[model samples]
Target: MFPGPTIPNRQPHREPWSRERLMYERAIAMGNAIDSTSRYTYGSALNSYLTFVRIHNFPVDPTEETLSFFTVYTSNFIQPRSVASYLSGVCNQLEPWFPNVRAARRSMIVTRTLEGCLRLKSVPVSRKRPLSLDDLQIVLSHFHHNPSHDDLLFISMLLTGFFALMRLGELTFADNPRLRNWRKVSRRSTVTFNDIQYSFHLPSHKADRATSLAEHAVSPTLIQAMGRWSSEAFKIYVRKHPVLLHALLFGADH
Candidate 1:
């Protein structure tokens, strides 16, 4: 024991961390993050955290400043929805480290991150867009003396669509309530477009992304041929026919 006071045998007081030890210890600790193949994904998140720490000597606490730093750092690059994949690793490890997050409101950023991207699209309304009698006439005119496939489809749509104002999905999809009944009825006689919606309990269709039908409505004869519709069932029918789309589009309601 040295003089001053007989110093009893004592364990050395541990020294505070040095920058060098921090770097070396960080590397050693990173070994834990590495996968069996020595790769880091979940481990890479650990790597990111360590790298962030080494770069900034950040504290071991989740603060608003920490959250801001993370949001800003990620904002450095534009990324796709695959962000979830990259972040799966970060989220797993940081979940315990990060504070609890409350339910967030719906916004463009959340929608974009989840849905990937936005697309400009047009879709038909399911609301009944009843056609005027004159517009019905324009649709009828397309029939001519003889009708082609397009003409027949066009005529069938118009004849049925006028009073019905149906969604394109129900029109195109044969499973429609009216279509199912029409299929059965059409077999009995030459079905008219007017009969499909007016007499039959045809439910209107709705629209959504990856769902619904296009906006364009078809012609009268098309309704009859396609749905085996009966025009006489309608309260009003196109009494005459016109020549072209413009005529129907800009027709004077009779």
Candidate 2:
């Protein structure tokens, strides 16, 4: 057989990136992994860290001792819980620069210092009270007198949202057009109804209140799926109603 037509040697379409350039690109990719808001928060944390080091004449590197001290010092000004969040942000920002920053942050010294700060500087939690059926009834009474189209619409949304356990974001579009996401919205086309009841396709819903009602009624797996929880982190959101707790403790026979 005739020798295969000799192929001419061709140069690579692209040149291999230098090690330094590759490293820089990788760091950029790491930053892009988190949202812009999260990046801003992390950037603030890093700035705080840099300021701390500069003022104290400490090394820029994040060592266990430095991170621990930073945690304690920062906690004195902000809430200890906020300090913890700040540390998490710091770790995210610094991890690319100092590969072992996470390990340093997680070290026993840093963790214990953070824990001690929390105890030393304890603040009362100021959580907003969740809306109840009584609140719903009050709203209904307000609209009952002279319900305009807008008023009726408000009542309809209120009822549907309460039962569906929808978030405020799901119920309404953002005032800022830039923030409004059509993909997240539930349009009229998604709704269906019969004489008995009406239902709509919710693009997403992760109501903590749903856990209060369904805690005993459903399996943990089902609850997690409904809550769209990737981990057991949903436990933090769980606020067991006293009645539900009592029922769980006792039985249907009781």
Candidate 3:
């Protein structure tokens, strides 16, 4: 007789998913269009704004908000950088169809919220640092010592976030081949040449104000790892022990 023990069968008690939660499925669909944190951060900003809006029964959406509340919203945030990120997102959306949406230049708009340099009166926002080659090398070297899924996840983020210069929100995991494009970009390290590829068409910044923004996406190797080839389906690289970000494609930086 085989020495292995018999396995017990089990089934989940919870329903597959609730209807209200299912409603969020649309949001999930849209969320799936982009990376994970895009789902979180953008959703977080929207939730914050909407919570404030619903609380006061504000009649207008963020775009239609009177300048007064816009000011209040800015002053209330602990981190005005998020506000800037949110506004920049809206600006991106309006520029293509509604050119008149963003009136003040970015400097002026930010001046209204995030504080300016030289003690200029504006919002006081947080600061962030860009990753350097030395920093990235250190991260990879550490990963080499401790091989794990997180390591692969970070490698993808560094490739996209720094090399491809993708935003946090755009660097989502693509567990579905239907969405992610797997095309190799390089073969410099132990990673295979064909293993390189990333997302080809990542979701755009829903709040950007620029009229002619650059194409978005990340490195190819990342896409291969995060992007799935399923029939249909679906971090931070630095600081705070880092996190996840699916993958990127070609020179894309969505």
lDDT of each: 0.44, 0.77, 0.46
Model 1, 1-254: lDDT tens digits are 66664667586788889999998898778545533322345665556645665678787443445433543454344343333343455554555446342111123344343343212221232443335566667767757778889888877766655445454544664453422333322232333347433344444322111001111344444534443435663213233222233344443332
lDDT of 3: 0.46
> How close to the true structure is residue 38 of candidate 2, measured as C-alpha lDDT?
69
Q: Give the number of the best model, judged by lDDT.
A: 2
Q: Write the per-residue lDDT of candidate 2 for residues 1-254, one digit (tens) a residue.
A: 78764787585688899999999998789767875556777788889989999999999899999999899889878999988888888888877679999999889999999999889997878666566567889999888887999999999888877778777777887685645567787878978999999988877776544533443355555666776876656554543344434433443333
Least accurate 10 contiguous residues by lDDT in model 3: 206-215
Q: Go through the candidates in order and give the clash count of each.
A: 23, 0, 37
On a 0 to 1 TM-score scale, where does candidate 1 land against the true structure? 0.26
lDDT of residue 136 for candidate 3? 73
Residue ranges of candidate 2 with Cα displaced over 4 Å: 1-28, 147-157, 169-203, 215-221, 239-254
